[model samples]
Target chain A: MCNTCGCNITPGNREFAYKPVNGKTAVSVLENLLARNDDQAEHNRQHFDKHRLLTVNLMSSPGAGKTALLEATIDALRDKYRIGVIEGDLETENDAVRIRARGVPAYQITTGSACHLDAHMVHDALHKFPLEGLDILFIENVGNLVCPASFDLGQHKNVTLLSVTEGDDKPAKYPVMFRAADIVLLTKSDLLPVLDDFDPERAELSLRNLGSRAPVIRLSARKSLNLGDWLDWLIGELVQKRGKLASDVLVQPVAEPQSISSNTGMQG
Target chain B: MHEFSVCQALIAQVEQIAISHGALKVQSVKLRIGPLSGMELPLLEHAYPFASAGTLAEGSILEIERAPLKVKCEACGLDSKVKPNLLTCRMCGSCKTRVVSGEELMLMSVELITT
Candidate 1:
C-alpha cells in the first residue's frame, strides 16, 4: 500500500495500481470502454490499406474447427496467394505452430485471461511480422463465440465458425455474433449426418429472425466437402480488392516456407 | 469472462478520469447500454469489484441508462423504439427503416469525490 495514500502500489502486474488521488474536489467525466479499442482498430485499418492487405477475423466457440478450416484454406491458397495468420488464444502457441506448419507466416497473441482479441493485439502482431507482399491476412480470434463478437480487430471480413454439433439455435441465442458476421461457416458437416438434433433449416430461420443476411456455408474440413465455395468467395474478394496487385501475388513465386523460421517464433 | 475484461477497462477509464480531475475517489459511473452493445450488465456489475480492487474507484456505483433500439422509418419518417427481433416501424408497418439509437455502449458521465 502507498504510505501517502491508502491505495495499492504493488510492484508486479498491477504495478500501476496506485497513485495519489487529487486534492479534495469532485470531477465529472465521460468516456466509453470501447473508445480506445476503436481508435486502435482504425489505425490497423489504415495500415492494412497501405499494404493492400485483405484481413479476415475468424471467431468461433471451442471445437468449432477454426484451425482445421484455416489449415485447409492455407493448403488450397498457399500456392496461389501470399497468406499470413495471427492466431489468438487465451494460452498456447500451438495454433500458430499449426498454421506455420502449412508454410504460411503465422503469429500468435496470447490474451492471458481475456476472452477476445482486440485491435491492440492485432496492431502489435503486425509490428513484428516479417512477411511482406501479403495479399491476405487472417486473425483467428480466441475460441469464444460470445466475447469475440464485441471487439472489432480491424479485419476486412469477419468469418464465424458454427460447428453443426453445437446445434442450430446458436444464432438465436447469440444474435449479436450472428448479426455481425460477414460469413457464417457451418463446420463439421461430416458429423451432421449422424447428429439428429441439428437442423440446417432451423439455423437459417434463426439467422433470418436475427435480421442477418450473411451467407451461411456448410462444409466439413475433415471430408473437404464444399470447400470450393469458401475458396471461391476468398478468391473473388482478393481479386476484387487487390485489383492490379492481385496478378502479382497470384503468381506464387516462392515455394511454401515449410520449416517455420526460428525468428518467426510467433510468440512475440 | 468478457465482462471481467470490460469492467477492468471501465475501472481504468474511471481511474484516469479521477487522476485527471484531481479527485480523491470515484462515486458513480453513468453508462448507456443498448441491446446491440453485446455487454451483459449483470456480469459487468459482478466484475466491477474485482476490477476496482485496491483502486480509487473501489465501491463505486454503476448507474446504467438503458438505450432501447430505436429506428427511423425512411418510408414513413416515424422514429421510435423498436423490439429486438422486429425491425418494422410500429406506426406505418414499413420495413424501410434505419437504426437511430440503441447501439450505444457509452459512458455518459462520472461522479467523483475528493477527500
Candidate 2:
C-alpha cells in the first residue's frame, strides 16, 4: 500500500487503479494531452533536419494509390535524388515490399491494432531505417483519412490523395484530413472518363469550402499520366529544402561555451 | 476508435499530475475539446472508463467544455465562429479564411485529492 495516496498501487501496476477519492486539496494541471506525441514529433523533425532529409507524409484512404504514387515517384526521381520510404500499415509488409522491389531502401512499420501511426512508432522505425545519403524520405501513413490527420509524423509536407472513386463529397465529410494536407492529389484519373458521377471540380470545391487552399493535382500513378506535375512538386520542395539547409550551414556559429550553458538551462 | 488511444493519453497525463501533486486520487478531469479536435465526444466518453480503469483517475468524472469552431477571414478580417464542414467566413462569406481555433484537444485541469 502506498502511504501518500492510500492505494495499493505499485509503480508497475499504478497505471491500473480503481479507487474513489477523499479530498483535501486540488491542483490545477493545465496541459495538452497530445504534448507527448508532439514532443516526439519535434524530435523526429530534428533528426530529419540534421540529415537534410525532405520528409513527406502521404495520407489517404485505403486503395487511394499511396503505394502506387510512391512507386511512380521513385521511378521518376531515383536518378536525380536518393529516395527512402517508411511504410505504415495495420498488418503485413505488402507496401514496404512493393517499395523495396523498386530498388529503394524501405522500412515497414506494422502497427498491430493501432488505427493511426503515431510519432513514437515512426521514431522506432528510424532506428532500423538508415537516414544517410537520402535526399527524400516518404512516410506512407496507414490508409485512413480520419485518424492519420490528427497525428504529426514529423513530415515537412503532407500529401493527401483522394481517388475519384471515393466520391466528391469526401472532403466535406473528412474535413480535418483534407484541411491538414499541404497538397491534395486526385488519384486514379484514368477512370475519370468512365465515371461521370465523381466530379473533380466538386471535390476541389468541397476542399476549398473546408478552407484548405492546398493546390490539387490530378494524376494516375498506374497509367503514368500527369505524374510530371507531381514530380515537379517533389523537386520543388527538395530544392527549397536544400536551399534552406545551405543557408543554415552558412549561418552555423562557432562552438561557444556560453551557448552550451544556455542549452543546459533549456534542458529543464 | 482512436478515442480509446486518446483517452489513454489523457489518463496517463492525469495520473502524472496526481503523482506530482502528491494527491491520493483524482476527483475529476476537465478538458476543452474544440469542434475541429477530430475527437467524437460520445466515443471519447465511452472509452474513458476503460482507459482510466486502473489509474488514479479510475473513478474520476470527466467535465468536457466544447469550443466553437472559429475562422478568420483574410478578405474581411473578421473572426467569427463557423461550422466544421463549412469553414467559410461568417462575415464576408470569403472562402479565403484561416482557422484560428477549434482544433484543440487540451486537458484544462485535474482536480486532485491530496488528503
Candidate 3:
C-alpha cells in the first residue's frame, strides 16, 4: 500500500516507484524531438547540395510586400540564376501563380491553418520540384513574422523583410525574428520619402539595437530603385554558399556537422 | 495564432503520458512558459479547451508558470533577468548581451488518476 497518496497499490506499485531508472531517457526523448527535425533538414540540405541549390527562406508579415519582392526578384534573377520558389500560405495559391508567371518553376504549399512550415514540409516539396539544374530556391514562408522564425525550413539563409509602410519599430517589436534572420531587407524604400513615419536612419538604428548585424538592404520593388544591388548581393551569396558546400562535400566525411545552424553570421 | 497549434501539441504530449501511466483520467497539467516565448497566455488558455476535448486531458486544468527572460551580460559577466521587449543588460548598460534562458516552452509535469 502507498502511504503518500493513500492509493491501494500493493508491493508492485512501490517497485514501480523506486526502481532504478535511467534519467537520461527524458533528455534523450527531448533531444530526439530536435534531432528528428535536424535529420529531415539535413536530408533537404543534401538534396540542395546534390543539385547545387541555394535555398532562402523569406519571412514577413501579411501584406508586407513579400510577393511583390518575389516578383521583382524573379524578374531580376531568372535570366541569371535558375530560380525556383515554394510559396506557403494559409489558403491561397496566388503567390505561386505570380512566381510561375515569371517563367520559373514554383510550388505552393497551403499550410491549411498551420502558422509555420516545418522542415518536413520543405522535404516533401523538394520531391515535387525537379531538383536537378536549379541554382536558387526561394521559400516564401506563410506571412508571419513570429511563428515562422521558430521553424527551420532547411534553408541556407533566412531573410526577414520589413516594409517602410509597416514602420521601423518592427525589428524592435519582434526581436526574435530579427535575431534569427541572416539578412534584414527593408522593402518599399520609395515610400520612405513620403511617409512621415518612415525614417531610414531610425529604422537602421532600431534594427541595430535589436543586435542584428545582418545587412539591411533598402530597395523598392515597385520603383526598381537600388534593386540591382539587392539582386547582385543575393546572386553572389548563392554562388558563394554553393561553392562552399561543394568544397566541403569533397573534403569532409559523411558524419560532419549535420545540423544547420540558424545563425548564418552574415553582418552588414 | 500559433497558440492553437501549440495547444494541440501539448494535448498530444499529455495524452501520451496518460496512456503510459495507465491513467484513465487526467487531473492537471503544469507548464513553464517563458516570458520571451512569444506565446500569449490568454490565447493559449482559450485554445486549450478546444484542444483538450475528447482527450485524456479533457477536464484537466492547465497551470502555467511564467519564467523571466535571463540574459548573460558581456561586460559585467552576470546573468540577469530583463524585460521581454528590452534587450539591455541589467547589471551593466551594455546592449551586447546574449540570451541564455527564459525562452522555454515545456510540459513540466502532469497529474493523472488511474482507475
Candidate 4:
C-alpha cells in the first residue's frame, strides 16, 4: 500500500524508497540516546578529578525539601568542608541565594521548561565555579524524580530525597530513581509520626524490592530531627575523599620521573 | 512529560549517526524502551516530529519495542519475565527480585539511506 496520496503508485511513480542498498551494506548502530550526554559526563568526571573534587548529585520531586535539606546541610558542614553548589531549578535564583547566604559559593542553572538537568549543563556551569579549592560539590538537580535518574551529572554519589508526605509507594512506583541512589534521604520524618498512612517499614520494603542497598536516613530539615546522622554521613564521605587525595599526593611525590616526563611531553 | 526532552536527545543522536555515516536520510529508528524506563511511549512518539524538525530524521518512523520487565528472584535465583505492573517473582512469589531490563532506553539500531 502507498503511504501517501491514497493511490497505488505506477511502476516508476513511487515517492517512498526502500532500496536494496546496491551491495553497500548498512551499518548497525546499537547506541543509547544518552550516550553523548554520558560522554560529556565522563569529561566532567575528569574535570572533578583535576580539582580533587567530590561531587554528589541530589535528585527529588519538587517540595521534597531538597533545598531545605541543602540549607541545613550547608549550615552544618560549612566549617569543616569547602562546599560548593550548582543549583538546578525550573526558574529562580532562590535556591542559589539561600546556599550563598550560608557562605558557600553557588551557581544556579535555570532549566526553564526542561524537567531535568543534563551533564552538558553541569559542564557549562563548572566554568563559574572555582573548583580548585572546593572539596565537596553538590549538583542539586531540577525538581524531578524520573528524568534525572537517566542523566548522570558527573557526580560521585547519588542521593535521592523522598519526604514522608509523598507516600511509601514512591520507590515502588518510581523505582528507577530510588534504584539509582547510593543513599535515600527520607526527608520530613518529623511529620511521619503524625501522618496515619505513611509507614516507614512499607517504604523500606519498597526500597528493598528494587534491590536498593542505599541506607535510608530519616531527617527533617524543618525541625533538625536526625540531622546529626545526615551530618555524619557527609563527614564520612568527605573523610574518604580527603584520604584518597592524600594517598594520591603521597604516590605522586614518590613516582618515577620518566613516566611523568612522557605524560608531560604528550601534552606539549 | 519528559518525552520531549528525550525525543530531543534521540534526534540529536540520530542526526549525528546519519551525518557521520554520510547518509542523506533516516528510514527508521528502532528503540527498545523497557517498562521501567520511566518514559511514556505514546508521549515520546508524539514528541518525535517536533524534536526532529529540520533534521535528517524529521520524517523517519520511530519503531518502539517495549522491553518486558525481567527480574532475577533473590530467593529462587532464577530470571523471570513479568508484566510491568506485577514485579513479583513467578516461581517463589517473592518481591525481592532484582530488575534486569526494566530501566532500558536503548536505540537498538537505525536504518539510514546513504546516497
Model 1 stretches astray by more than 4 angstroms: A1-30, A243-268, B71-99
lDDT of each: 0.78, 0.87, 0.75, 0.81
Instruction: Write candidate 3's Cα lDDT for A1-268 as tens digits.
Output: 3222224435667455433233211100121113345567888887776666788899999988888898988887767778889999989888899889889889999989888887888888877878667788899999888888766677889888899899788877887788778888889888887888788778777766654567888999988988987787788888798678756655655453443221222222
Best by TM-score: 2
Interface RMSD (one decimal) of model 2:
5.0
Candidate 4 per-residue lDDT, tens place, A1-268, comes to 5312113434465324224365222445566667778889999987886676779999999999998998988888778778899999989999999999988999999998888999999989988777867878999998888889888778888999999999888988887788789889889999987987988888887887666668898999989999998888877886787677556655785467664443222232
Query: Residue A18 in candidate 1 has what lDDT?
Result: 31
Q: How would you order the candidates by lDDT, starting with the best?
A: 2, 4, 1, 3
Q: How far out, in Å, is residue B17 in model 3?
A: 3.6
lDDT of 4: 0.81
Q: Note the residue pairs that clash in candidate 1.
A: none
Tell me the interface RMSD of every candidate, in Å. Answer: 6.3, 5.0, 8.6, 9.0
- CA error at residue B93 for candidate 4, angstroms: 5.5
In Å, residue A91's CA in model 2 sits off its true spot by 1.0
Q: Give the TM-scores of the predictions, in the order they appear.
A: 0.79, 0.90, 0.80, 0.85
List per-candidate RMSD values in Å.
Answer: 9.4, 6.6, 7.6, 7.8
Per-residue error for A260 in candidate 1, Å, reads 33
- For model 4, the superposed segments whose C-alpha errors exceed 4 Å read A1-25, A242-268, B83-90, B93-97
How well does candidate 1 score on lDDT at residue A3?
23
TM-score of 4: 0.85
